[model samples]
Target chain A: MIELRDVHKAFGSNRVLRGVNLTIPGGTSMVIIGGSGTGKSVALKSILGLVKPDSGTILLDGEDVAKAERDAFLARFGMLFQGGALFDSLTVWQNVAFRLLRGSLKRPIEEARAIAVEKLRRVGLKPEVADLFPAELSGGMQKRVGLARAIAAEPEIIFFDEPTTGLDPIMAGVINELIREIVTEMGATAMTITHDMSSVRAIADHVAMLHDGVIQWTGPVADMDASGDPYLDQFIHGRAEGPIEAVR
Target chain B: MIALAPLAAVGRSTLAMLGTIGSVALYAAITLGHILRPPFYIREFFSALLTIGYFSLPVVGLTTLFTGGALALQIFSGGARFNAESVVPQIVAIGIVRELGPVLTGLMVAGRVSAAIAAEIATMKVTEQLDALVTLSTNPIKYLTVPRVLAATIALPFLAAVGDIIGIMGGYLVGVTRLDFNAAVYLRNTVDFLETADVVSGLVKAAVFGFIVALMGCYHGMNSGRGAQGVGRATTNAVVSSSILILASNYLLTELFF
Candidate 1:
């Protein structure tokens, strides 16, 4: 389980996250939904220790994340970035096997490559694509490659940041399905942040609505539509006029 | 208050400059600290050695060669004005070995390697590859900055030595062919006039210049703002800062050596 308590983060005058408090139970997919620039990414990054929060505590499995051994703490989590964030200098298999090739998770090159190929196949990419660079692949293929790399180490926790943001609807559905299936099969604690309604529906067991740098509403996906919160309704139905203003 | 606005602006600019200098110094200290620790990236080090040293051979060689030939001609003409044209080989040897060789090579490498390093690193930061490296349990300073800085620092002295030799050869070529000087005598004069300390000092300066070049590149790159404009600005800053530091340090090193 991951928990954030009164997390606040600001960049200069812009307070991106203001006293955000949320929790995700073990072995479940929790999707955070919000409009652009509403601190969804910041919240996820805070949990991962990528972004440090001011005057807040993030706990992973009841251990304070900021105080944990960095490598050991990070070794348990895998993340797929919003832009894929694949190393352009490396081939696809090298990117996937990056964790396996170095640090405490070191493995033999042949074994690592074999595992990378397997993960690629698991993510719907052909083994032949292993030698190709990220620039050679399509955006959807790159996303799949990113997914493959994320799960290569078989981490206990996984983060997906705007996983389906730039994909075509069909491809986005495919990725959404893959993520849902992978999270179930791995039984890993999954935390995803996306604004896509379909992705939220397909991948989320629990939904958290972040607005105004806080969680406006959070509950099981089944209870999301009838949560009786105007902000939640306005967000889910994509309404322009409501208690939540569309313009900044 | 309005009349004093210019003075306040100058004060702000000075403070900002000092802040940037402090940040860069702190960054260098951290990088040096990491260099003494474990988990060295040997593969990356060798890759940087190849990029910073071996591939830079042609450019360094060409620049020194042309500068050497030009220096010989100028020195010969200047000597003729005092009826001392025989001093060409001696002056050329000392000038190339003691100053021109390393300074020119350093400036050239600063323009080439520093800009390349800044642009590549800034692009990686923009793309979140640096963050990705962190997520993968790899330190970007160890994997990226240390290797490049170490390679440049170690490789540049050898490059300056090579540049010195090539530069002397250029003078020799010009001295024998363009001027009516005997080849054997020119070689002998150059050999007799050059001291080992002269060459060593230039090599030392090359090493320091190399450190400055890579450090500036990594610093600007890591602190780059977002987007294409940011990367471009970082590249320009890296080259400009490295060049200025190289020239400034050259004067100080010359004072220490002489």
Candidate 2:
């Protein structure tokens, strides 16, 4: 289980997170949705320790994330960054197998390559694409490769940041379905940050809406539609007019 | 009337400069600390050597050659006033070995290697590749900066030695062809006048300059701001700062050697 208690983070004077309290049980998916600049990404990053919280305790499996040994802690978690963040200099397979080829997870070259190829297959990428660099691939293909990389290590916890951004509706739907299938099949604790309503419907088991740097409402994906909170309703229906000021 | 504003601006600028220096210094210490650590990537080190040293040879050689030839001509012309034109070969040798070769090579590498390193790393940051590396449990400093620093430090002395030889040859060519000096006499004077210390000191300066070049490049690249504008500024800053540091350090190195 993962738990965040009164998490507060500020970048200079712009407070991005304010006393964010949340919990995600093991073996489930939790997707955080919010408008631009609402700090959805910051909340995810705070959990991953990419962005340090100004004041809070992030507990992963009952141990504080900040106090954990870095490599050892990171080894159990996988992350797909917003841009895919694929290494341009490395080929697709090399990027996928990066974790296995170095540090404590070191494996033989052929074995690591085989695992990378398998993960690529899992993400719907052809074996031929393995040797091609990230720059040569389309944005959607890059995202698939990033997904392949994220699951390559079979990490216990996985985080996806804006996974469905910059793709067509059809492609976005496909990615959303893939994320749901993989997260479910792996039985991993998944935390995804996205504002794509389609993505939320397709992938989220539990949903949380963030507004004004706080969790405005969090409940089962089914309850999201009937939530009485005006902020949550405005975000859910994509309305420009609501209690959450559109201009701000 | 606005004395306070100017004073505050000066204070802020000074603080910013100090912050930069402190960060660079701390980063340098961390990079050095990683030098002997395990999980060493030999491939990266070899590739860095090729990029920082082997690829840099032609530019270093050509720059020193032209400068040496020009220096010979200038020294010969200046010596003509005192009927001391025989000093061409000796002065050329000292000028190349003691200062010009290392300084020129340092500036050229700063332009080539430093800018490339900064731009590449900054682009990596812009694209979020550095963040990915962190997820993969790889320290960017170890994977990126250390290899280049090691390669440049090891490669530069050899480059300086090669540059010094080429520079002397350039002067030799100028003395024999352009001026009416005896070829054997010019060669003999250049060979005899140059001390072992002169050549060694230049090579030492080259190593230090090489370290500075790679260090500044990695520093600016790691701290670059967002977007193309940010990467461009980092690249420009890397080259400018590395060049200035090279020139400044060259003077200090020369003063010590002399």
- Report the number of the highest-lDDT candidate: 1
Model 2 lDDT per residue over B54-147, tens place: 9999998999888889989999999999999999999999999988888888889999999999999999999888888988889899999999
- A1-248 per-residue lDDT for model 2 (tens digits): 99999999999999989989899999999999998998998888788777889998999999999999999989998988888999887899999999999899999999999999999999999999999999999999999999999999999999999998999999898899999999999999999999899999999999988888888899999998888888888888989998988887
The CA lDDT at A165 in model 2 is: 92
DockQ for all candidate structures vs. native: 0.82, 0.81
Report how far residue A23 has shifted in candidate 2, in Å: 0.7
By TM-score, who's the top model here?
1
The residue ranges of model 2 lying beyond 4 angstroms of the native Cα positions read: none
lDDT of 2: 0.92
Taking the tens digit of each residue's C-alpha lDDT, what string does model 1 give over B130-179? 98899998999999999999999998998999999999999989999998
True contacts kept of each: 0.69, 0.81
